[model samples]
Target: MRGEVEQLVGILFRTLAEEGYTEAQTALLDTYQSKADTDREELAEELFVEVVTNLSYHLETETEVEVLVTAIEQLLSWFSSLVEAAPVAILAVETDGQIEFWNDGAERVFGWSKSEVHQRPYQDVFAASSDEMEPHLAQLQDGKQLTGLETQHQHKDGSIRDVRIWAAPFRTRHERFEGATFVISDVTEQKQREQRLSVLNRVLRHNIRTDVNIIHGHLNQLAETVDDTTEHLRVMEDRLSNIIQLSDAARHIEQLRDEGEDGLTTIELESVIQERVTRLRKESANATIRTTLAESTAVVAHELLPYALDNILDNALEHNDAETPLVEIAVSTGETAASGQTTVSVADNGPGLPDHEQAVLTSEEETQLNHSSGLGLWLTRWIVRNSSGTLSVNKSTWGGTRIEIRLPTQTS
Candidate 1:
């Protein structure tokens, strides 16, 4: 029993050292190191008796040696509760995708029992997770950690759950690569709220006010003007339809924002451009338009890209003052050869964009004084920015203005 008590005291000393109880560890070591001639057995016995004596005045536990051993075991067991109490799914896996540890939080998040998924592969929790999983493993394989990786995960009932995962390569104390630690948090409701708020803000700010003003202004114009209001009414009709189209485009942008990068598609630039150009020619019969599109020009854009293109073309014609109002459209690759980008250049034989309009598009830091009058160029710039692209303004060789938009080949 004395030997057993000594062994337990040795363990307690080691535990205190490991737990960063520096003062207690120093006191315990000083007992023996200060007197090297003292027998270890006597020294451990002396320390054990001192702890039982001191703890008797503090904690409610018994002073018996056997009670002390039981207390230490309980302390070690209690440490495991931290993992169970965590709010997010906490899981540990092996390099071969074996599930090593799954806490209670993991069970609640994934809806899987410990007995059913103890040694199962980690991929069972994911649903069509290839897009992010490939990059995740590549980073882990190179000993890097990834955070805020939003991906799709499959629940036990086969329903898709939206979650943001934080992962890192797990290793043993000897630096051997094991698997990884995955912390998952569900963000579906949060994302939905964000999307709803964005749509409401847009409706309140731009869409509703513009539609009401256009209707009211047209009504007043016809009431006051007794002369030929046919041409004026005709322009009002186009403006009314444009309001609907742009409002829908703004809603689509909100949808894409909610879906993140997974919602985008590879769009054929030539096809989208040719369709818009055909419509433009029919809309303005007197305006001369030309297009130069290559056979296979492509860009990664969302579905609302045509709305942006049409607005740019409309701006060129509406602002033209030349006798021959000519618009030139060309599509090709940009000079940044490493980045796969499809550049769309639209030039017109007009008075060109004002300096303020040009500054808003090309400036790094814009002030209140550098604002534009209309939303035409702002809408075009917004579309390009949201699609992981860039917009530039330059003088066209056709003696007017040119707006060069460069779109990249990847989604955010």
Candidate 2:
């Protein structure tokens, strides 16, 4: 006697044949046909349960076989086209880390056909660094799904590739553990472009900035001579320095974006702030620069903290038209019931921050109109954000702007 499941499938298959769904149905079955006998049976069992569960309404109502099969065929066709149309590599992996199914996209990507790689160990064929594979394998072993995982893969030609993967664990109809499905996207070109940009930015900010700064220093000394070209040299020097500052801010912004919040670490904030303040005091010798830092105060932040702070302090000093620009830095640290916090406040007796720039600093979104004038405030904002900190600009006691960076402590 035929079982109910088998009988249902038989009736559905005949109706599919009559409705011209045989080709799509055959292609769907062919995927399971490629697996080993045991794996094929398991996959079919899962698929059977899925089909039965989905069409339970039709079965209960004794709906016309033709209607049911047409619905099934449409679903099958959609699945087939979806699998075939995917642009990235797709693989079905078993629990023990063996390859079960490799789509055409996978074959084109990894340079191996399904016939060649079927039933093969996944690690042996698709190579990745142990460091990179460790987390993924652990996740799979725990029957967990992962998405948008960025890692590297070794190619048939012994070349390395940067790839992103979205993977999920599968299960059988009886709730038995099966394997994982993976979609991989190659990102070698994307990674290479970022590298090239990093190199170019470093050259512009470091080497080029260095050469221009030298000229700026010489121009300043020449401006004191009262020569005919002294004023022109001074103007050129000032404008050139502005450009250099923009480059510096841009470099800081790039680092913040590339490294992200996870790159923050613990460091003594007092020393970094003091070192930068001392340098700024010497640079603007006429300006009165004061600092109030707690002893041995530390904060969790990116290594670019000194550079970012310099930009803030530089703006406070440079934008001042006062005869004696007064800029003060106050550093403090404290603890709450949950976490500790550190704050660095830079208050200046200069023209307050521009409304547009303040809007950029406070904005959570980036649009052309609400963007920073250059990169100074934006860089500071990103640096603070990436450090798991907050930035606020408001009126200072000296009738100027006070920029504050508040950083949360890293939990042990």
lDDT of 2 by residue, 268-309 (tens): 878888788788888999999888988777788887777679
Worst 10 residues of 2 by lDDT: 1-10
RMSD of each: 14.8, 10.9
lDDT scores in order: 0.74, 0.76
Task: Please give the TM-score that candidate 1 achieves against the real structure.
Answer: 0.51
How would you encode candidate 1's per-residue C-alpha lDDT over 1-412 as one tens digit per residue? 3565766676776665555656655666766576567677777767777656544543445423444566478555654686789988888878877788888987888788887788887765565563546667667867888789877788888877789989899766687788888888988778778868896868664856586677868666775775555777667666766666556656665665666566557888888888888888998889999999877777887555676788788889988998878999998876555768888889999998889989877775457887876555565666677677788888888778999888875433
Candidate 2 global lDDT: 0.76
User: Backbone clash tally for model 1?
Assistant: 0
TM-scores, in order shown? 0.51, 0.61
Determine the C-alpha RMSD for candidate 1 after optimal superposition of all C-alphas.
14.8
Top candidate when judged by TM-score against the true structure: 2
Q: Report backbone clashes per prediction.
A: 0, 0
For model 1, the local distance difference test gives 0.74
